[model samples]
Target: MDEFLKWYFSHNPVAAASLGAEGYDHTLGDLTASGWQTREREQVQWLDRLSAAEAPSLDDAIDRDLVLSQLRGSIALASWPEWRRDPAVYLSTIFAAMYTPFQRRLKPEAELVESALSRLAEVPGVLAACRANLDPDLAAPLLVTRGLGQARTGRNLLTRTIPAMVEDAELRARLAEAAEPAARAFDDLVAFLEGFECGGTWRMGEKLYSTLLREREMLGYGAAELHAKGQAAWSELDARMRAVAVGVNGGDDWRAAMESLMDDHPPTLADMRAEYEAETRRAREFVRERDLVTFADGEECEVLPSAEYTRPVLAVAHYLAPPPLSASRRGIFFVPYTPDDFTPEQVRQRLRTNSRAQMPSIAVHEAYPGHHWHLSYMAGNPRTVRKVFRTPYFTEGWALYVEKLLHEQGYFDTPATELAHLDCRIFRAARIVVDTALHCEDMTVEEAETFMSTKASLSPGTAQGEVSRYCAWPTQAPSYLTGAIEIDRIRESFQGTPKEFHDRIAGSGGLPLGLAEQVALA
Candidate 1:
């Protein structure tokens, strides 16, 4: 099992480095058709070997289940035509290869600069390999547009933003020398993609969607059942949001309450950072003071502005966990700032999304008891299987579950804050609806965008970005709500305190909810 997990990381060096694995620091993974085929074949063999392996103990049994689930889902995903059709898969993988190491800063500046330069030098070849793999007819239009956007952003990051951060003159000169070829490759990709007459189809159809939910997520329910769950959750949250708005503002109008809440946003990006920092500290203190759950020793993280290359796809904020093998225990929470080129309304939209009222929940979600907290727990667990296979259902679900746990513990004080938290729930519920509908029901991206903006109360730009991501990663958007609901259901069966329940779930190293439930009962 350890050898299989090592092989998985070995095939994707960039991902290995992201997980704190050593030795892969200076190399980029191959991004060609032949490379993917090699990975696909290896995964099939690994899956067979893993399924047949005996697990004599309960812990070993659970570990085997985790590996099998991940291997099966990965092989199923690899079976998709998207590998040959989606430019985003090839391009984004390359983009992350560059972005992850730099953002984590696992190595010192000089070492980091050397590794980055090595990867940068490989961009042209990676681009050529990607071109060889893609079939224009199968390339979805939404992915093409997304790929072009990321290419533009990646080019800018290589030429502009990245070099500005480095101080070594020799390194700076090397970066400048490498920037042109990388930029030209990006341009070539953008131009080639732009010539495609129609947008590539983004929908995965019902068969693939069901397979994803069953094999990847291990969900017991189907699309219609999940859609109903989303609708029910949305309705429940909507009522709570309105009730809180009425209590806070003497009216039941949630939008107006939200508008009033947005009025308290930071005027500058620096102010936003300060607000996030303060709230993060407060949330951390609250967890300790209240004894919410045990935190890992030396668990810490830093909050910074997101990388320029990721802005196209990232929502308002995202958490990048430390590489599992890295010495640094610090995870990074990237908050998007208003770029200088943005119009006035765009700037306003950015600020509103990160409004002051929402900062506390965001702090809790991204920091204290959310991603950073869960990752710290995982870091302490020595099981390689636990470290290797990550389910978004576990990661995102644990964060969502923690948010509600804090709320119930009276962490959210003001009506505005409570409303903000509920709105986050609403957003996830909306995701469940839109994600299933888009992939299974043939709901257009435009329709999904409208559903998010109107029903989820997301801004037009944010709604569009959410819809676009759902198009690319089917079933991921709904994982937050699905995982949280499963955890909550299992928690209801536990006759213990919130801390006890959290310890049981998180102590198992972020397992699938179904497996976690079984283990807890056993």
Candidate 2:
């Protein structure tokens, strides 16, 4: 297991660095076609070795199964042609390679600077590999457009964000010096993608989507069953949201109520950040007073404005988990308020998405007793595999689950807040349907955007951003509800209090839903 893990981390260096593994911070993994083929062949050998090995205990058995599942999923998806079809694979890798070291700041100042410089030097080669590997004629048009935007963002990160983040005069100077070539590399990528013709479809289709659910996620059902489940969930949540909206607004028109709530937002982006910070503190205090779960020692979270580079796709907000193996466990919750470049109407729409009524639920979901809290527990897990291996099924599901848990605990102070929580839930439920239909059924990207806007009641801008994410990332959108349902089911069968159940499940780290059930119910 140790040997295999070492090989795995070395081949997936960006993931390794994100998980706080050393010796990989300065390097991106091999991005060439041959490197991918080599890794695929090596994964088969490891799978055989793992299958042949005996687990000495329950933890060992679980760890082995976790590793095996990941290997099998990777092997299954290897033939999907993402390397040729998706340019974001390389672009995202570049972003993470630069962003992780800067964001984590776990190492010393000089060491961090050195690592950044080394990674910046390697950027041109990685982009070269991307150009060599990606087939423009086979590229998905939607992804191509998205990738072009991300490449521009990458340039902004290199030329602007990182320099501004550095306070040391010498280090800032060093970064600015090295960042020039890397920014140019991004410019090259942007030009390449701009000239390329893209005519491919983004859908993974039913067969691969099924493999994602069953093989990758270890779910019991296939896409059809999951889609049906999503449809049912959406119907129930919609009815509940309407009922809640009637109580809040004296009418059953939930869309009107939701829109009204949007108007009650902070006047400025700085004010929005302040509101989120306060709400996060309030949610944490409530959880502590209620004794909902155990908080890890030295765990900390910061609420901040989303980086300019991330606002393009991140839409409203996102949470960045701390590296599990690092000395610091300070997570960041980023609120993406409208940037200065946005039009007046675009700003209004973006602010509406981050309204005051929504802030409490967003804080609860992204901060207290949600991702920041749940992931802090995950970071403390003594097992390396448990720390590094995460499925969105568990992580996102736990986040979504805690939103309801807090509501039950009377965290929401008003009918408006309650409606906001339900609105968030319904959005996740809608995600299940949209994600399934977009990949498995005949839902176009435009159609998915419309479903999100009309059915989920998201702003048109937010809806477009959400649909783009679903297209780029299949199987992930459904994990929020799927994992929550599994967790809720486990809770029903557990012989303990809510706090005890929460502690046990979250402390076990981000296991797959199936394995999470086994551990939580043990």
Candidate 3:
């Protein structure tokens, strides 16, 4: 296991850096054809080795299964044309490679600065590899469009956000010097993408999509069944949201109530961040007072503005978990403020979606007892495989589950806040419908956007961005509600208090729902 992990981290340095593995901070992964071939071959060998070995204990068995699932998922998708089609794959890798060192302060400033410089020097080569690997004839039009936007954002991150993050004058100067050429590499990528005649599709279709859910996520349901389930869940949540809306505003129109709530947001982005920080603190205290779950020693979370590159997809807010292997377990809850370049109407729409009534639920979901809290416990687990491999089925499901848990405990007891919380769930249910439809049910990108806009009640721009993300990442959108439902089932069979249940499930790490069920039942 140790040998395989060392090889894994060396080839996938960005993932290694994210996991807090040392010795990969200054490097980026190889994105060329040879790199992929080597990784695929090694993964198959490791899978075979692990499969032939007998487990010494339940923990060993679980770890062995976890690694096997990851390896199988990788091997299953090895034939997919992502490297040859998706420009975002390479661009996202470059951004994450440069961004991770800046996000985590585990290393000294000087060392981190040097690491950034080293990664900066590799930007051109990585982009060159991208140019070599990508076939314009196979490129997905939507992905190429999104990739261009990401390239622009990467340029902004290198020139603006990152340089300002360095505190020391000399280090800032050194960073700026290295960042200049890196920014130009992004410009070159933008130029290449602009000149391409990309007309490929993004759909994974029924077979590969079902394989992802079954083999990778370890789910029993196929794409069609999951789509039906999503439809049913969305209908149920819609009814509940309408009933709650009637109580909040003396009407059964949930959309009107949501709009009213949106009008109650902070007047400015700075104020929004302040409110989120305060709400995060309050949620933490409530969890401690209620003894909701155990917080790992030194677990801390800070609310901050989102980086420029992330603002496109993560429009409202998202969480970044701490490196499980690092001493610092502080997470970051990022709120993406409306970009200055947006039209006046766009700014209003963005702020409205991130309204004041929704702040408590958002805080709980992304911080306190949501991602930060859950991931902190996962980070403290002794098993390295558990720490390294995370399925969205468990992680996203746990985050969504806590939202309801807190609401049931009277944390979001007010009518408006309760409605806001339900709104969040409704959105997740809608994700199931859209995600399956887009990849498996032949739903067009435009149709998915409209479903989100009308059915989910998202703004058109937000809906468009959300649909694009679903196109890029199949099977993840439905994980929020699907995981929550699975967790609820596990809780029903468990003979323990809420804290024990929460801790047991979370401490099991982000396993597939099937494994998580085993842990919970045990």
- For 60-156, candidate 3 gives per-residue lDDT tens digits of 8888888888888888888676888888888888777777678877788898889889988999888888888887667788888888878878777
Instruction: Give candidate 3 regions above 4 Å deviation.
Output: none
| lDDT by residue (tens digit), candidate 2, 1-522 | 789889999999988988888888888889899998899899999999999999998888888888888888888888777888888888888887787677767877788889889888989989988889887667788888888877877777897888777779889899988999989998999999898787877888899898878977899898999999999998998888888888878999888999999998887778889999999999999999999999988999999888676677678688889888776789999888665577888877888888889889999989999999999877888778988788999999999999989998898879899998888888988899999999986798889999999887699988999999999888999999889888999999999999999998899989888888888887
Query: What would the TM-score be for candidate 2 when compared with the true structure?
Result: 0.98
The TM-score of predicted model 1 comes to 0.96
Which candidate would rank higher by lDDT, 1 or 3?
3
Prediction-by-prediction clash tally: 6, 0, 0
Q: Mark the 10 consecutive residues where model 1 has the least summed lDDT.
A: 193-202
Q: What local lDDT score does residue 312 receive in model 1, on the 0 to 100 scale?
A: 73
TM-score versus the correct structure, for each prediction: 0.96, 0.98, 0.98
Q: For each candidate, C-alpha RMSD in Å?
A: 1.8, 1.3, 1.3
**Candidate 1 or 3, higher TM-score?**
3
Model 1, 141: alpha-carbon shift in Å? 1.0
Ranking by lDDT: 2, 3, 1
Off by over 4 Å in 2: none
